[model samples]
Target: MGSLTLSGRTALVTGAGRGIGRAIAIRLAGEGALVTVHYGRNTKAADEVVTAIRAAGGSAFALRAELGEPGDVEALWDGYDRQVVEHTDDTGLDILVNNAGINVRCAIGDTSPETFDEMFAVNVRAPFFVAQRALERMRDGGRIVNVSSGAARMAFPEITAYSMTKGAIDTFSRTLAQALGPRGITVNSVSPGIVDTDINAAWLRGDEEVRQAAAEVSALGRIGRPEDVADVVAFLTSDAARWVTGQVIDASGGSRL
Candidate 1:
């Protein structure tokens, strides 16, 4: 691919403050897309991502809005519209990465109603509404990538609710792709497994035994990195993936196979 495959395009990555989202933002910016780094609460981390992008000669700015709350989608887009107008004098977006989601590690029996509701609120409801609002601002031939999980396909009873949310995302991608096909827009979901990010640090970082267990889950026999998933996302947002839509591409390093 060319160094600036996405030159002059505008992209927004939710949860861009850190982890896989951060990697996606940086990668897109490096490919010459003006990026909006959306963060929920970590102002410092979000600002740092913007700084890193700028320092790398890429353009980016940070926007903050906690997801899963009342009016969260509107608040996020309001900020996004203003920032995009100021930066590019356009209110349309070229790429939308719905990467923000929360996971609650509880089995069905142990999961409370409150916890279940909260997970759906953030993982399912927020992304659905965010995409609904984003479609209004996305330009023709735009790209939409929802970050999902391998747990959605394989049974992981420990995070049954979280897996359900991801399954919903995959379904959302398929239906939305058909709806937007006339506009040449693509909607797809990516499922990653056992990535070594802060969210998994508690178990995967210090304990060698736990780390090895996680690694062995992947056929590659190694822990997946944030960039591993980010690269897949970057490709989906590029023109090369124009003919690809409504598919749930797995970035799981052959996990469970």
Candidate 2:
């Protein structure tokens, strides 16, 4: 909030209707970016995020794209083109945040093939294609932040499929960063630990034992807030991280260290 780090930039954040995605959208808007809040099914939540940004004197809009399905990337950009034309008349985007994902808790023994496929479809396939298509519309020197999970590095046997998907994301970011480096584009992954969002509220809030157990996983001795990860993403998108790319920045509060 001190300086308009992203002033005049246009950002697209997927799965922004709630949870960590919502926090990133708000944070980027606060830094003066024109944000497009993308949601899959929760139109009401998406609208609320737009409303909150507008109320804060920021520019924002909402778009929908059900990721992991056929033509999902195309549908997303179709909306993006119209919105950008109506709002800024700019043809290029400055920031792309792949924050839309799903996690299913299932151990390897009980994991179904269908569940594994769906996880890869949404978490890995969707984001990969989204970046591929977005490259056509992304301006030089743009930033792309892929939302990964600490589970990629740490062992989460209960959610093996989800963890595997995140590992794919980390690799995608690293490889894409090199591919886009000549154009001044930076691609990086931000891996966050357990955050106190609606997604984790079931076990993170109002349950003293559960909350404490989760907190103890991190060196910080507390569960992460949405804003905690948001701030890290904002920094990566800003000029401050201009030289940083092809790296996985773990925003996990020094877990297991």
Candidate 3:
């Protein structure tokens, strides 16, 4: 199971309280990386994840910071500085997974400025800013995996804004891979299809008709679980993926066809 060995490294995962974020954080810790689970506002959820990681005999800690805000980013960095630098002395972060994002379901006609701003803030701007911060502390061989979605390419009537943000992430990842190539850092995006998570349980697994349609259309013949996507993300953040960068691996069971 530990094919992607991240032993002796440190990882920071954003929005790691629940759903896909939590899955990724747990997987990274299980692979022997010291994981810091970051949440937006869910203290209890973050603590639960930390507890689970600890129970699995892995090193983990719970951190909270609001996504898409400069103040929150500073606070996060300060906390990381105290906790990580004091322990490691070197202060170089090994892995950063930008898995936090906001999805707004609004058609073009119904979209408001505030809603658009909010979506872009968390989905688009936050990743870029976080990546910038990560680069400052990342070593030469650090890995950055940004969580994207098939909606970035698939045209959905009510998810235009959300798709735009994801599209930007795809582009951002590719561009960053090139920018950080000389530094030996890899940047890639993992686009998941319809994943069965608490956030979208009703759409992907609970609703019989929706599940049937997704299964019939997908080549894998089933909806994706959080662990399914989490496994791929964990791989991309490992040494095997060092040569593979600036690419988007679709973990969608062939759904974007």
Candidate 4:
């Protein structure tokens, strides 16, 4: 079997300051990709990730842009362009992982219009625009992996808006794959189940009972870890997944089955 490596490639992973995004950035760097670690507001966490990568003999740098805000996508690429000029002469990218997202859980009755708009803006609009602009600098045979959630496939009325946003991402990936196929670019989505991250710590890690209940949702009988989702994303970003595109790979550990 061939090994997975991203030597000589450049990758940009959004929300890399912590959680799944951080894990993804580190994993890609370990595989030898020159990584751009993006953060929304946590520059320190992002810098720490970059420092760790560089200390491990990998190349990485941190970029900042708050998604869901006006002009966010352009600001992100502006940083990317500047960093590319400073780090390498190449103007193309090899991988783009749209891993940044927000989840606001509320019942249909409690979901306000403001919250609904914010969720869609951050979870759907940001990624869509990011990919649209990224294609211009993405090389042939490059990969785009959208981080989706099991909530999109299963019913989660408590987080209806959040789930809806992920569904949109799945569609975006499928349609984009068809659009970019002629250029040999692959776009896919990776949907994960309940993962133990800062985002879910409030509930999943709050009590043993809650944690175990979350774990039981998966056949593995354990709450998913950020690394679990990150590894799947790494595979999809690698050339090994070149033949795979426009598909939503479930990294959900047999949830909702």
RMSD of 4: 0.9
Note the Cα lDDT for every prediction shown: 0.93, 0.93, 0.88, 0.93
Candidates ranked by lDDT:
2, 1, 4, 3
- Alpha-carbon RMSD of each model: 1.2, 1.6, 2.0, 0.9
Which pairs, if any, clash in model 1? none
Task: For candidate 2, write residues 1-257 as lDDT tens digits.
Answer: 33338999999999999989999999999999999999999999999999999999999999998999998999999989988878897769999999999988899998999999999999999999999999999999999999999999999899999999999999999999999999999999999998888877766798899999899999999989889999999999999899899999999998876
Q: Let me know the TM-score candidate 1 reaches against the reference structure.
A: 0.98
TM-score of each predicted structure versus truth: 0.98, 0.97, 0.94, 0.98
In what order do the candidates fall by TM-score, top score first? 4, 1, 2, 3
> After best superposition, candidate 3 residue 202: deviation in angstroms?
5.1
Per-residue CA lDDT of model 3 for 1-257, tens digit only, reads: 32499888999999899999999999999999998899998899999998999999998887778987768678787787777764455667999999998776789999999999998999888888888988889989899999999998788878888889999999999999999999899999999988777767645666788778877656888878889999999999998888889999998989857
Off by over 4 Å in 3: 1-3, 85-87, 202-206
lDDT of 2 at 212: 94
Give the total clashing residue pairs for model 4.
Answer: 0
Better of 1 and 2 by TM-score: 1
In candidate 3, where is summed lDDT lowest over 10 consecutive residues? 82-91
Candidate 2 wrongly placed segments (more than 4 Å):
1-4
